[model samples]
Target chain A: MSELISGSEILMQSLLKEGVDTIFGYPGGAITPVFDALYDFQDRFNYILTRHEQGATHAAQGYARVSGKPGICLVTSGPGATNAITGIGDAMMDSTPLIVIAGQVQAELLGTDAFQEIDLVGITQPISKWAYQIRRPEDITWAVARAFYIASTGRPGPVVLDFAKNAQIGKAEFYYKKCEFTRGYIPYPEISTKQIESAAQLINDAKKPLALVGQGVILGNAENELKSFLEKADIPAASTLLGLSAMPTNFRLNKGFLGMHGNVGPNMKTNECDVLIAIGMRFDDRVTGNLKTYAKQAKIIHLDIDPSELNKNVKVDAKVLGDAKVSLKLLTDAIQNAKHGEWIDSFKEHEEKEFEKVIKKEVFPENGPIKMGEVINLISEASNNEAILVTDVGQNQIMAARYFKYSKTRSIVTSGGLGTMGFGIPAAIGAKVAAPDRKVCLFVGDGGFQMTMQELGTILQEQIGVKIIILNNNYLGMVRQWQELFFRKRYSSSVMINPNFGAIADAYKIKNQEVKDRKDLKKAIDEMFSDDKPYMLIVETEKEGMVYPMTPAGDTVTHILLGDE
Target chain B: MENENMTLYTVSVFSENRVGLLNQISIIFTRRRLNIETLSVSPSALKGIHKFTITTFSDADTIEKVVKQIDKRVDIIKAFYNTDEDLVYQEIALYKIATDQLIKLGSIEEMIRTYNIRILEMNETCVVLEKTGHYEETQALFSELSQKVNVLQFIRSGRVAINKSKIERLSDMLANLNSRKPEGYVEDDEYAGY
Candidate 1:
């Protein structure tokens, strides 16, 4: 028989068995026992005590996105568990694997309105992939194993393990059996050969074909497979926001980004393609402007691991269900090698038109207040296109996503699905922790920067090397942009009286700088990337700058506005 | 609610007998604002597995998504939706009437005879009647009795459904689930049959 161990030890052991060495969390009433256990095993784990529970969950999400491992976090019950809800929802939408262990009132006191008592499971059920409560010591091993298994499987998402006070202190014989199977759970669905063949046939028969890729390619570790399929079929590929880093920016068949604020070429060409192959991407409303007018001319083919995502948005002519790597390889093998040089060249005219109107001006502006794009472009060059670009929501996210180039896979980490603000500081810290050797740069707006600026303390304490570039526009830029076009520029609650970010960084004992001129942008970025210690560079950006080449909400993808007009 | 796309659909979900599973399933319907017309839970033919049969009104798209979401649960084995025409179904209704008052309504026994209702118990004060049929048939019997005599209490069971594809498909699926044992896996002894 295995040696008797406390439930807290068993929990620690189970996490270790799953190859987890780091945990981001905060302590409170119900989870004190587990924290006490950590006192002894401190050398074995890098437990990060984040300033807030929400920051911990977002940090774990960023870790998960970068490492392809299920990020683990712990917090005490009641408000602690509730605080993690937004991050859990973000992880759910992003398909980022996270295992959140929240403390609970004792098994006996549960539902009695006891101190720190909350229905963590009930609250997390919708947002989490699975929420299981461990009420006894014996359940710890299996529950931990199950939580990791479910959180990291097919479409990765957050799993909450509600550890009760009794469970934390209860003693039981430790068994290290890994949960590889559950009776009713099917993590991976078999790839249907018939679906593959029909999809290949559609690809082969198409006159002009385009494929839009999403984060599933990176999640499936199918970047090479996608490249092969795109090359073999000679298809021009566009990327969803989450799919930014799946292919290198300089790849031959790479067309551009897709969505509301995406490039002009892909948005316009979406209507021109005869066959639209949606690979590893759900047709989010952002990508499909007006469903009625979006891709009506094309025969839609969707490929995803989740069956529900097949026809969830737009009806598809074909459904390829399986791991993307497997399906893409099958497709690459099934379809005859061919090239659509003339068809591929059709997007170039639209690209040059956008370049002259938007890209050239945004990134290469000669003067005026500092533009957001120039900062990102300078960072990309300064870091040699090797930095993992993380961003807070709004203009900075799209600006960095557009201007920053990626040379590494799994390099773009952001809250894509939920679009949560205050996600940047902690997420970038977690990213740096996950990839210590890789440079990590964050592009955040002034409004979002202060939302979770408390995590600057986490960086200083952990000494995490995350280069934070705050694009201070003195307004909630994305909302203001929308207000400018859609809301008649009323600017309700969009403007902000900013904080002294440099002083905040100084208080946190981290290196800091601020630049207002365009010429100083390159030098500031270079300085931020020079060393392996955390640095924050605040750049005062264009107060009223707008992200152009936008397909107005519910407007057809083909019809886009290049300028504010 | 009056949209032409709306139609009655029976969503049958098979899952392990698990705590909070019902609430999770209910949330799926509630979130969509689709009211559950009827819901029944019972042990399935397979040991350790329970089946929940729910009937609701939804458009084709919403129902399809709802069933898929139900099937996505970790403890859930499978979920399917069928129109009334696709399933052989029935609901059983029970009626309790005051015996003395019931007899005063002329031709009540004759009406019961025509409907093939079985009298479960009778006393000086009351009588209980049971009828099994489609929803409308059972409702018709209840309405007839309520109109003529006082129904002390009336109750109706949720619809029980079986796919017309035959029992072989069900057995085949059960067998298939049993065969799909992942590595280092064993069914708990509580689920003895599997």
Candidate 2:
């Protein structure tokens, strides 16, 4: 017979059974019972108390993205649950696995508009992979195990569990068990061998076959398999922003990034390839500019885990549904070795021209304020291409994607789909927590940094060793760039009279430095990385600096502009 | 062509009977800016589970995404989208007419035979009639009755549908789930009350 235990104890036991080592959360009135229960389990799992529920959620996302495990978060009801909505939406869009447990008002007080009462399960339904409200004490263990299973399966996403106050305090007979199967929920779809064989036949027949890789490669841990497939077939590959680290930057077949502000060759040559093999990417509009003209001539092969993604965007000649590693291995075994040397060299020629016209001036500027690109380049060099780079949205994100060369998978974490602004610092904290031995670096813009700057308190409290570099452009750089190019530089509300970030770091008891000169860029980065503690470096850059090679909205990828027109 | 191309899709969702599952399904429609023409919820053949039938006007692409989103909900066992021609559907409607108007016109008997509506109840003040058919057929009867008799009230239940396929999808899914169940976990029949 099983012994009886409180719902709070059951919650703690379920987490321990799942092997959770850390959880990020905030305390509140309704959640006090669970917090008290956590006090006894402090030796079992380390809890990092964040200042805001949003920060805790983002921190959880960061940890999930780095470790490929379900990140756990807790918060109170009403305002606390509402605060975590953005982070939940971000995780859903980016396919990050997270388990968020929220404390609700007592069972009897529910729907009575009691204090700290809200319909968290209903509110989070559209955004979460699953959302449930636990009513009975016996359901706590079942709910927790189910939540983790749903969060970490298939296309991973966030799941919310709302615990009624009474349920937490109530007692029930407990037997901790892991949920292995969910009715009607198929986590992994069966891979069809016929589809794999057809995909191989198409790849073998193409003269100019190009591989478009996305975050699926990293999620599947299929980086080595993808590398082998690309080399065996002699196919050049380009990465979507989130797929940055799937292949090392130094790989010969790596054609660099592809998108609005990506490399010259990848964007321009997308239309030129005869066959386009998309692995684990949904072909969102940003990656495929103006779908009417995007790779219309290419015979497309889409490989993704989600069956719904097939034929949703660009129609493909063949569709392979399964994990990237499994699908890639099948394709590699069936494919014949062939050389596309001429097609690969054609991309290099375009890269040479872009390097002469744009890359040279941006990375090795001689006389001006420190350019954002140069700072990213210096940091990339100083970090030895090993640090996990977490970047915020807007211009800073694009520059980091452009300049930083990652040599490891799961090395770049950023807000790709939702493009949330204040995602850098909190997510960096989560990444550092997930990978304590590896160095974690953050690149955030002035506009985005201010959105969640309160997380500096969490950094101070936990003493998390994340090196943060804020690119102080004194304006919303991406919006300003759009205004300059598209709206004739009206610059409406983009400019900012920002505060002293260094001083803010000081107030939080974190070490800080400010560098405005180009000569001091390397020295500042070296100093920041040399320290064993948390440090924030503010690098002031030219306010008018813009990310170039942008394909204007609704335009073809071939019509990319190298600079402001 | 654009107006004609906009199709009406019927989405059927099977889920466990949870308190807020209906509100969650409605929210998905609201987010997509699709209006719900009709929504019906009832218990399924399987115990402890419910089924929701929702109708919306959208193209194939939008309906596909909506079905995918609905399937993402934890309680939802499965969601299927079908066109009007793919399903056998009907709605029950009730119409109340003033008895004096029918008596004065002397066409109540003839109208009942022509429209295939049954007289549910009759009194001096009013006569209640019931009809079972597609929405358009019911609306036609209402229009015909209005000209002949003074119509007092009209109401229609939402659509209930069954796919033309021989086997029920829910039974197949449940069987699959049963086969994959781990040890010590009970089936839906043994699920404790919420």
Candidate 3:
């Protein structure tokens, strides 16, 4: 025993036990003791002092997102703790694993007008996966351990630990033994065997079956299982934004992304499918243009980890709630090979006919501005078929989904639920941090890049080599496109007078290049890829460019407008 | 230095009974130093609660730190400025003036109306007048009417001092240290290492 230690020490000890190497935090009166204790452990743990509490939280988010480790941030009481709300909400919406520690006024002083006191647990309750306040020092070890487990396991998200000031100073005997989490709250609802059987039945009987993969597939690492099912059943697949890179986009039956901004092949086929095996996706509103008419005739088979999500949106003929990997394995085992030759023929014919419907205009002038496709394609080529592409949410996110290819699960990180701007660059920095040697390219929109422009400092400071490809459209093209399609072109507050990204990179002493034409895209990327310092490529494109084939909001998926048609 | 230019300061406010008054006062002060010394509230005989005092050692220049914070709290009806020697002030005690004695001096009616003193009770022999205000103001009103009526015993509160303006002890200490001959400055705490 290392003598009796305070709850704050136990919290730090639990982090060490979990092999957490670093944390970000700011100090204040209520949390001073924790920082004081941390002083002695500085050699064992790296603590990054942030300029602001929110900065610490976002940095932790960046660390966790890329490292595949639970990110941790510490903040002092009252306003300091409240400052982390935005970052916590970001983590919650993106389903990233993060741990937040906030110091509270002493238990005796709680609800009293004590100095620097705030009700942090109640404030953070709605935005966190779970929030707990430790009034006793003895509960620190278990609470910290449980926080890690809850944050990293299942569908990951942020968990908060609100520690009272006294708990940090009070001493108690500490142990490092790991204990099993009480099963009562674990919620091990078994996957329905009948539903699995029904899923198999649907897979065997249907023609033109499409597998719509989402983030859950990556969370479950169901790529191999998914591929096996797809190959055995000859089913084509389309990925959601979060699901991008869950399956190799280069595969023969990959339809790419399927939604408003997705590929023509996936969107058209999604409407034409007879059986849709919607695996690991929650059928977000973005994916289902008009819920009533989306996959109108297709019988749906939904598989997810959270049972509550099943039939919460579109009613399914079969709903399997277990880990997607396990569920897919079981469902595949139950299926026998059956050929839907007529369905396959119809899908291929429809794909070709729709492919012909595209206007096929060479929008990029021969030597003029760089097209978004050309940049994405060059990055794909330079990647040598092995790099992970992380995308920010915007038109770039959509373009990457349509064009970028992935070879493994969780190879890409993108904001799906929150559609938060500034997520891409930091998340890319995070991905690079997680997979140091792998080439990681961040696809960001000009609008989204500005949200986290400061993280470029961290990139230079840490010397993390991440290739940033900024699509300079000068507007929030996604929302603007929505405005054009449905909101009567009232594009308010969507346009951006973006700064010169190359200049910004130069200010950070980062190597950068500007791509003006499709012809220069490949050469620019190749030249930048050879150097090690952080590089940014700004591709200036048309100002009012709109993502096509947009399904108007609240309208049927089938009610899509073809720009030329 | 402690009396004229302290690094920290606290001040107390006595006000009419009302809701959400403390919040308004504290927010203004907290927004400044984000520090509070100590605050106490209790009932006084003048039909309102008596605020004890703040013992902040800060100088007059930074006194706005306290005043601005107090303004945001809802309960405080008004704030007053005080120097250490201006009046003998104590936050404790209640004083009552009687009407029968004022009639003898022939000054009771004018003083009572001007101060808006309430008549708490009446009998054949005496009537009690209740007046609530700051200790100094109450005392002033008490003295002006003292010759006219039989003076009753008055209660007094503890010492709560506000420093004169433009003196800050901590800033002076830092300035003094900086102006001294060159010496290696080693931080006393781990945080100062930054």
lDDT of each: 0.89, 0.89, 0.71
Runs in model 3 lying further than 4 Å from the true structure: A22-32, A35-67, A113-117, A340-368, B1-194
Per-residue lDDT of model 1, residues B82-133, tens digit only: 9988899999988999988977875666776888899899999899999999
What ranking of all candidate models by DockQ puts the best one first? 2, 1, 3
**Per-residue lDDT of candidate 3, residues A478-535 (tens digit):** 8887787678999899988878889999998889998766677778888878976688
lDDT of 3 at A536: 90
Q: Model 3: how far is A324 from its true place, Å?
A: 1.3
Error of 3 at B9 (Å): 58
Candidate 2 — which pairs collide? none
- Stretches of candidate 2 above 4 Å error? B165-169, B177-194
DockQ of 2: 0.56
For model 1 chain B, give the 10-residue run with minimal summed lDDT: B185-194
RMSD (Cα, Å) for all candidates, in order, is 1.9, 2.0, 18.6
Q: Per-residue lDDT tens digits of candidate 1, residues A319-419?
A: 99888988899989999888899998888899899999998889898878888888888889888899999999989998998888988899999988899
- TM-score for the A-chain in each candidate structure: 0.99, 0.99, 0.91
Query: Which is better, 1 or 2, measured by TM-score?
Result: 1
The DockQ leader among the candidates is: 2
Q: Model 1: what TM-score for its first chain?
A: 0.99
